[model samples]
Target: MVVPEHRVFDPASSDDRSIYDRLVELGGVHVFDTTATQLHSLRALLPTPPEDVLGEEVRWVHYPWRRSLVRVLGPRGFRLLRLDRNRNKITAAEQDDMARLCVGVVGLSVGHAVAHTLAIEGLCGELRLADFDDLDLSNLNRVPASLFDLDINKTVVAARRIAELDPYMSVVPYPDGLVESTFESFMDGLDIVIDECDSLDTKLVLREHARRRGIPVVMETSDGGILDVERFDLEPERPLLHGLLGDLDASALKNITPEQKAPLAARILDPSKLTPRMLASVPEIGRTLSTWPQLGSDVALGGASVAAVVRAFGIGTPPPSGRIRINLDAHLAAISEVEPTASGESISPANQPR
Candidate 1:
């Protein structure tokens, strides 16, 4: 569990114990100081006098999980330098507006990449992450985790990584994945919700709530870079999942067997849209593979794609509700045809679904 109170420490605060004394108490803790570089960058960005910029107080952020302390500029100066490269393209004003939004992500497999990208791009001020499962050893193929993270709750792993990257960002982790009990609070105050969970019932439930609340929902299928967006915020009357699972409610999906889930999933994610490799893997799931295949590259690409859509929503230029494929294979194909076994042959055995 992430103790939000102890996440970031401000040495400038009027604490009873001095920061130096506290550091001495917590011996062997690694301390990182980047205040000088941050101040220099701050000076270059602003026309304010050196004295004024120099007067900006430095804060010490403590990462209790890592037993490390980092010295950084205050929120204003830190954000300026952290997001400096987003200039003109994402203008400072746009970034500031983005920072005010709150985003929630469910199912931490693909959601892990989405959450990390959101934090790295400074797209949201707070992130609410919910995933019931722990990090499995086999999840490393696409999950942004490691051997040490094995067996740890996925939400905690993701939240800790985000905290290490930007202590200023608020991350709330729900170890127990979403259920009827926590769903309301999880959806509360969220400007956008990203569904990456594996449960078909949960997906239906998520949209039911989002539609009622008029909150937009985004989902990315690791196959074919399929991105699904439901602008419930703009069109409250819109059908869930673009009416793919016509009038099917979560209640009907409860306790469904694996055999029953396959056909419904196909209906939801049209079989015609599935990549050739993914379509082929469907029958072999129980025979050769444990589950559907997802590649790290595809997960990473989906992360970038989702971040772009979320950013558009933040800037109030969100695309219409629908599904779109950002298939890299189709876009980056060879221009000329070649005979079998020819040099520079594109076909490879690794192209099969993992």
Candidate 2:
């Protein structure tokens, strides 16, 4: 009968004795027999076979000493020796690339969902989370936070939760979300920027900065199930957000107070830049907003999906960028390859003289 390797019997512990006796009664022999000759013979069998092969012998036989040894030693133990017996789905190169990626996520509401998904997918190494807002009763409706987190700042909540999930991960939290004062500090050393902020001006500012630095910017708008990607790397000169405002330059647009920027940016719709049919549909869209509030589930799903795409991008995986739109309501998704142009070639979307 072939015996397993790395088995030790502890006679001092009652629990160990009970386990040993049960195994012995079940026709199991300890790998190291007590006979003096057996000890010399087993020692002669130096450099034992691989742990997986040895593990199979003891798989059915439970010995507290061996189990405890394996538990304490981790992968050095019998069970962990068999871990490589299974095939690896992800290639070593891909894992290496994922390990090197550092992504910064802005806005913890939907951003948390994105970060959670990326961590689960094993795509990010370091995550810089920025958010000024605190957890409120209203946030629980859509964010990943628990009811117990109410009233705590969002950055603190996200950092704590993510740390618990992945203790090895590096999470840098900026309790204050991006602002003109904090912009320079936030943009430093980020590989990719995720624009989950609720302000259009903030999005524009982020896009400009990303464009200037040749960083890619991805934005998800839950209202229309839109996942827009501005690959500044591909088209450094293209106006940000696909020139959504038609001809209005950021400077030409009415100067908005910081307090008013959030909501006004949300409601500001540049109809001219949209397809004529879509432009006509705006009135209908307005009516829908007046009649029914946007569903939280829809927004949450949008955020999560966009985050997945971004993770794929970060890990050397191709993302469906260049203006990709996925409309859950219509079950339609499309991608448009944008052509790069000179920065001053076209009039600012908002500044096109009417």
Candidate of highest lDDT: 1
Q: Write the per-residue lDDT of candidate 2 for residues 1-354, one digit (tens) a residue.
A: 011223343455577678667766776344432234422333343355444533332222233323322111111232222222221544445655665777778888778777766665556677777888889887776787788789877877776665444434567777878777777777777778888876555677777888888778877665556677777867879877777555555564445544444333444333334334444444553444321133567567766777666656754665634655555645433333444346645554434457
For TM-score, the strongest prediction is 1
Question: Among all windows of ten consecutive residues in candidate 1, which has the lowest summed lDDT?
Answer: 334-343
TM-score for model 2? 0.60
Tens-place lDDT per residue, model 1, 1-354, is 344533455555657237656775879888899888878778887444356445767778777667787888877677777787787778778998998999999999999999999999999999999999999989999998889889989999998888777888989998888987889989988899999998999999999999999999999998889999999999999998899999897899999866577778878779988889988887777568777889999999989999999999878799989989999998777334434445555654435336
Once superposed on the true structure, which residue ranges of model 2 sit more than 4 Å away at CA? 1-89, 247-294, 332-354
TM-score of each: 0.89, 0.60
What is the lDDT, from 0 to 100, of the residue 197 in candidate 1? 93
Question: Model 1 reaches what TM-score against the true structure?
Answer: 0.89
The local distance difference test score of model 2 is 0.59
